[model samples]
Target: MTSSAFTESSLTGIPVKRGKVRDVYDFGDRLLFVATDRISAFDWILAPGIPDKGRVLTQISRFWFERFTTISNHLLSMDPADLPLPADTDLEALRGRCMVVRKTEVVPFECVVRGYLSGSGWKDYQATGAVCGIDLPAGLKQSDQLPEPLFTPATKAESGHDENVSFEVMSQAIGQELADSLREKSVQIYQQGSEYARERGIILADTKFEFGLLDGTPILIDEVLTPDSSRFWPAETYQPGGAQPSLDKQFVRDWLETTDWDKNSTPPVLPDQIVEKTREKYFEAYKMLTGEECTW
Candidate 1:
C-alpha cells in the first residue's frame, strides 16, 4: 500500500460536500465527484485510507454505468480534463478518481434491492417472517437465494444507520408514483447486474442505489453497485447454510467484529495486514466483475 491516499479533495470554483467516502463539488450546472480512498466500517471513517481504492471504485462504477444503459444515469464523463475544472486544479491527482456528473434533484431515499437473504434482510426475516413488510417463505437460511429479488427501500440518513421502512411508508413520503418507479427501476438494475455477475463466478447478493430527478425524469445517481453499497460473494464457495465468502467490504466488517471496540464510540485503527488484505479484496472484486485489471 502506498503512503499517499486521498481522504478529501478541494477544487476552486466549486462548493464541496463530503460524505463517508465520496467528495462532491457543486459547479452550479454539474457536480464533481471524487471517490477518496477512505474506508468506513460501522459508519465510522477509519484512519489510513486504502491505497488505490478510489481508482478501483471509480472504474468499477464507470464500468457498470456504461454497461447498464437500459437505465438513465447521472454520469457525464470520468475524465477530469474534459470537465470545466478551474485552471489551477490538479488534473493529474483527480484523474481516474473523479467524475463530472449532471446535477439533479436527488430523491431522499435509498433504493435497495435484495437478491438473497443476508445482512439485515436475513435478520428481519428471522424475526417476523418478512423483510420490510414483504413476507418471505418460512425457513430461509442466511445467504440463501430468495425466490425473487425484492425492492426494499430505506430512508436516507446523514448520520448513523439508515432505518428500513415499508414500501407504503416510502410511498407516502415520496408519493406513490415516484416510489413505484424507483422500485421498478431498482429491481431491473439489480437483476441485470446480478445475471452478469453470476456468469463471472460472483454473486451479487444485495445492493443499494440512489436516484435523482433531472427535469422530472428519474435517473440513477450516486455510487451504483460498489463494494461499499453491495455484497459480493464467491459463487463457487457459496453455501447458504452459513455466511458465504465475499470479495467486498465483508473482509473489513468481519475483522472489525473481532475487535474489542464497541459498535458505538470511536473506531480503532486497523492493522497493516488488515488494510492490505482489504485492499486486495476490493481490487479482486473489480477484476472479477469487469474482467479487467485496475491499472492504478
Candidate 2:
C-alpha cells in the first residue's frame, strides 16, 4: 500500500522516548513500543522513512517471541486496544506495530551471538583472528561460518555504535555469574533461531539480544531476531568471500554509500525507488521468516 511514513507518534500526557527506529512510551509498569518507519544510517535518522517498515519489524519480533516459547521475552501483548490511550490516539496507525510489554530493569549490555564471520565480527577476525576476545580459526573468509557461535558482549550506548567488549570486561561490570548466564542464554537462543531460519532457506548469520532482569532473572527484552537486530543472509546465494545478499536495510546503506552526504551533517532524503526497494526487503524478510504474507 502507498502511504506516508509514521516517523513519530503523539499521545497526550504520556512521556515517550524516541530511539533509532522505535518510539517507547512509558505507562508506569508497562511500556508501549511503537516501531516506526524511521530508518537510521551512520548514526543519523534519515528523512522520509519507508512506509510499512515499522509493521515488518514489529511483526517479525512478534513472530520470534511467539515461536520460541522456551526463551522468556518481555512481550505482554502486541495489541494495545485495552490501554488507556488518549482520545486523539491513532490506534489504526499503531496497528501491527505496537508492543505492550512489562517494564523491567534493562541489562546494560548487548548479548550478540555470531555464527558467521561478517560485519564487525569479520573486521575483528581480520585484525586479531578473534571476535570479542574469543579466538577463531585462521584463513577464514569474510562470510565464513565459524566453527561455533560466539557470544560477544557490547556496551549499549545511548547514541552511536555499541562498543564491543570482552567477556571478562562484561563479567567485571555485571558479575561473573550473571554475565555467564546471559552469554549462555544468548547463544542458546541464537542456535535455535538460526536453525529455524536455515530450514526456511535463510541463514541467521548473527544476531544481538537485549535482556532485562525480572525477579533476579534475565529475560529477553527489546527486539529479538528482527532484521534490525540480526544479519540474515540468503542461504542459496551465500558467499564467504565477501558480503552476501541480505534481506535487510543493506539496500538503504548501499544507496547512501553512493551519495556524498557527509555523515557529519543531516543525512539525505531517500529517493522514492530506494524507499520502495527497502520496504520490499523488510517485507520479504518478515514473510520468509514467518511463513506468511505481510497483508498489513
Candidate 3:
C-alpha cells in the first residue's frame, strides 16, 4: 500500500466532475469513474482519507458487478490501459482505482433496500414506526432484522444528505411503472447480495443502488455493493439491539461522534491510529468478500 492517499486525479484535456469520493471524467460515449481515497461522513468530507480506499471500493464493486451476470450495469472496463488518455495521465496510479462505464442518463433516486433497521431507517422507525412509509412490526430495535427487505427510495442529492421518500412519492415523480421496476430490481439485488454475504460470515444489512437508462432500458450504474455504499457487519459479532460494528467507514463516523466538532462545518482529520485501523478494516472486508488478496 502507498503511504500517501490519492484524493484527486489530474487528467489534462478532459472535463471531470468530483463527488464525495470519486472523480468522474466524461469520456463521450463512456464515463471514467476514478474512486479517490477521499472519505466523507455526515455529509462532511474528512481529511487524511484511508489509503487504498478507492481501490477497495472499486474492486469490491467489480466483484459484484461481475458476479451478478443477470443484472445489467454500466461497467465496461476496470483496466485503465483500455481507455485513451491524455499524455500526462498516470496509468499505474489509476490501475485498480479506475473504471470505464457506459454513460447513461442516471435515475435521480437512491434505491435503498434494508433487511435490518439502522441509520436513518432506525431514526425514522423510532419517530414514525416506518421507513419511507413502509410500516414495520412494533418493538423493533435499532438494528433488528425486519420481516423482509423493503425498497425504500430516496431523493438523489448532489450535495448534503439524500432525503428518504416514500415509494408512492418516488412513483409520482418518476412514474409508477419505472418506479416499480427499479424497486423490484433493487430488492432482488439486495436479497442476492445479502444471502451471499451471510454465507461468507458477513451481514449486508442495507445498501443503496443507482440505476440509469440506456436506450430506454434500466441498467445498474454508479458503484455497486461497495463499502462506501453498503453496511457490512461481521455476522459473528452482530447484535441487533443497537448499532453494530461494521467493515465500512461507519467506524470513522463513530469516531467523529466522539469529537466536539459540530458536523455542520469541516470535520477534523482522523488520527494516525484511526487511519491505520480504518485501512485495516477496508482491507479485511475486501479479503473476506473476494477470498483473494487485494494486490492493488
Candidate 3 local lDDT, residue 137: 90
Name the regions of candidate 2 deviating beyond 4 angstroms. none
Q: Model 2 over residues 37-81: C-alpha lDDT tens digits?
A: 999877788889989889999998888898888868899999877
For 58-158, candidate 1 gives per-residue lDDT tens digits of 88899999999888999998887766778799876777898889999999899999999998898899899998899998988999999999999888988
Q: Give the higher-lDDT candidate: 2 or 3.
A: 3
Candidate 3 accuracy as TM-score: 0.98
- With a 3 Å backbone cut-off (N, CA, C), the pairs that clash in candidate 1 are none
C-alpha lDDT of residue 166 in model 1? 87
Best by lDDT: 3
Clashes of each: 0, 0, 0
Give the TM-score (vs. native) of candidate 1: 0.97
Provide the lDDT at 113 for model 2.
Answer: 93
TM-score (all chains, Cα) for each model = 0.97, 0.97, 0.98
